[model samples]
Target: MTISNESDPFYKRLSLNLISIGLIAAALYIAQDILLPLFFSMLLAALLLPAVKFLQRKKIPKIVSIILSLTISLVLVFGILYFLTTQVLNFLDDSDMIEDKFNGLIRDAQRWVSQNFHVGIRKQNQYIHDTAEKIKTSGPALVGQTFLSLTEIFSYLIFIPIYTFLLLYYKDLIKKFLVDSFRNSSEHQVVTILQECQNVSQHYILGLLIEMTIVFSLNAAGFLILGIPYAIFLALVGALLNLIPYVGMLVANIFCMIITLISSPDISNVLWVGVVLMAVQFIDNNFLMPLIVGSKVRINALATIVGVLIGGALCGVPGMFLAIPGVAVLKVIFDRVDGLKAWGTLMGDPGADKQREKLKDAIH
Candidate 1:
């Protein structure tokens, strides 16, 4: 007997799954204001979990352990912020000199363009004037957007730690809730998913931190050796920006080169700056990433790029930052749930699939 289309388990499950994903995406976008802080806090809580557990094991109260962990995290965060602020202030202090140098460069560029492209200096000046007028017209909207961004940043700073503390204090309650919610699945299966998710989140975060530190060191050393002005500040900025994945390093490189050009009259220094950053980037891509971060997630490049692009489209930078860990967690859960093994494979690297196949063959 043939099953009706409506009664067919395969079609029913597929439709339901598609609807569920759509609903999830809608909820994530609609409730991002509330959820972004919570999601960010979840990552922080995961990173601090071991420290909290250790403190509790040492006879500290759960509340006190969480507070201590958050306090330490905040101190570290504030320290970095303070450094960035000081660097920015110093950069601004020399802005007048940079501006003068920039004007000189503009003149040189205008002359070169006039000689080669036959563009008049008057036309170039008029073009610059028109661009300035456009910027002036848009200045008010830009100011308003900047104000909104600052407000959002303040809100995040206020709520993230509070959410993190609550998450840590109620970790067991949350785990219990997750286990209960998956009643159709075995408790062992639910727990295994939770454990793996935590492992992936923690390892991914720790790996990123380690990778950033190494990159910062390498960059700073290289810049110093090359006598690049604002070496430490430029290095720090590049390293921090590198956290954004594929697009970040290229942006960092361009930014550094621009700043170097503005600060130095020697045209050769710009190329040297590029060379130093390129060498560091080469090392990072070849050695540091594979050793520190790549092994943690095991996502294929296609999935990672797509996830990052989708995340950026949906929720901007925070979404992009969370994409890899989020996808890794999803992969773990999918691989464990028999129906989703195919999806897990789709997201995972070829090496991971090979290992899985070998294990299955051995088991058979």
Candidate 2:
């Protein structure tokens, strides 16, 4: 005889959790466009909230405080971008003097094309014409798509500030909505999760800032010592890429190689870039990141890799930035929810994981 659903607590709990997971996945896929901006706004708000709160305590009106904080944030962002863009002009000037890269690549391909396909230069030219004509046919749509992507980026830049300001200005209202949304959840648990979320956001963002500053300074100084041109620009690029976790440094290295190949006087400068990047990564992974940011987040290696991958899968670059803190927030909720304590522990510091196992043994 089949077990009655009412009598099968284990199966019932598992089924409910599976359904909840499916619903959450569907909602995330369905609402990603709106949710990505809101999530970004929440993160920026977290970073700026302390400044807003300080100004508020100084008798500044909420609107004034928000404007000031956002203004400062915008200035810092634009200042960094401005500095980089100015250096880019130098690259453009250098590019004008440099020979075209494809000329050499095309020259190298001539022997293979001739030998493998018995093709002459004139035939190759005709094929190239056909390809160019194909590209011409598609070029207008490609240009339109490029503009649409830029427009989307510009819209995101505009909305993120507005959303962050509103979030900071009406944080209490948001808090109440979050706490009240869970009718079956205990008030104490709800409050605890909210507080933990706040703490996670504050610690993660602040620690990341500190880590980026340290990395940027050291990388700049190292490049300076090596007599690297555009030292600050390269350092800033590297530091920003480092924010992505795991794969970021490799991408930064490739970027550095390209810039150095173009800008440096000697080809040996490319080798120096690699050595310096490795040294910087060693210092960061061993000393700085662990002490500053990693300790604050406490996500284990497996969970972190999975979180970053999942976040990247979900929302690309923004998701990578969000992965750690998002996992932290979920961990807070999971720790509070009775049946999900094990999953939370897996997401959390593994040092305490054994303690959870022993506690379960004792209770059973």
Candidate 3:
């Protein structure tokens, strides 16, 4: 008997799977406004659960514990915000200096263009003027959009905490509901998956927070050593941006380099800034993250990059932020489910797999 690969059941399943993915992607894009806040709150609630439990052990009411946890979190968040705001204000206070430096850079750029490309200063000036005019015409719409986004964020500020509190308070009910919904399935698997999900969420979030702190501290120290202006602000920005995985670090590095070039007298500052950030990143990828975060996810670089890009294309910034954790959760689920082992492997690091194989060899 001859078997044709294209006519196999596998091909039918593949087509169905591809169609399902497309449908899911379209649904996610459509429902992003509702779902983003919900997803974000779920993660936040997971992060807060341990604190809430700890407080409850001290004879505190669950409600009170939740409130306390929320308060502490808010205080920390606002404190950081205040610092950022102050730093930004100080940076803005030097607007005149920045303007002068920017003009010098522009003039130098125009001259270089003229020298190399035979484009005159007049053409450059005219091009810049046209750009500025276009910007002037469209500025109001951009400002309006920014204002609307900020308003939407502020609205979520109210709803997210409420959702988080409800999730925490009804954690057992949610778990029970899930278990009951899967009544036909193995209770053992459901329980295991639920427990693993909680563990992953808690560990991943706590690890991420710790990792960000360490990265920020290292960045700030490096910037301070180099006497960079607005060091704290830049460090915080870089560390936060670095949360998006590989692409984030590149963007953050470029941003810091631009800041250094524009703010400092010497171009050497830009190179030093790059060196410091790169060292910090090297430590982060190799040591700090591995130790603090643990390697439970095991996603490969290719999948990570692809996930981030697809996520960004789907729902912009929040989507990018959600992509890694979302993919990690999917991997965890796929690993537990029958016949999905191939998917788990596809999403995982080949290097990690090899390491596991080598360890098994040694043990045997």
Q: How much lDDT does each candidate structure score?
A: 0.87, 0.82, 0.86
Q: TM-score for each prediction?
A: 0.91, 0.83, 0.92
lDDT tens digits by residue: candidate 3, 1-364: 8869767987776787788879989988999888888888888898899999999999999999999998898888789889888988988999899889988998898899999999999988899899999999999999999998998788678888888999999999998998898889777788898887777778888888889999999999999988987899889988989898888999999998997788899889899889989999998887666555545666787888999999999988889988888888878887898757778889888686565455457658
TM-score of 3: 0.92
Going through the candidates in order, what is the number of backbone clashes in each? 0, 0, 0
lDDT of 2 by residue, 1-364 (tens): 8998787987787788889978876776678777878888888898888899899899999899999999999899889779888877766676643445535447658767998889987789888999999999999999998997787688788888888888988899988887788757587778888887888888888888888899899889989999987788789889999998887889999999777766676879889988898899998876676566665577777888898888888777778888888887888788889988877888877654454455456658
TM-score of model number 1: 0.91
Comparing 1 and 2 by TM-score, which wins?
1
The local lDDT score (0 to 100) that residue 18 gets in candidate 2 is 82
Best model number under TM-score? 3
By TM-score: ranked, best first: 3, 1, 2
Model 2 vs. true fold: TM: 0.83
List model 1 lDDT by residue over 1-364, tens digit each: 8878767877777787789878877887888888989988999999999999999999999899999999999999999999989999999999999999999989999999999999999999999999999999999999999998898899899999999999998899999998899877688899998998888889889999998999999889988988888999999989998888787788899999999999976778889888987888888776676657666688888898888887777788888887888888889988999877878889988775455455457658
Question: Considering only N, C-alpha and C atoms within 3 Å, which residue pairs clash in candidate 1?
Answer: none
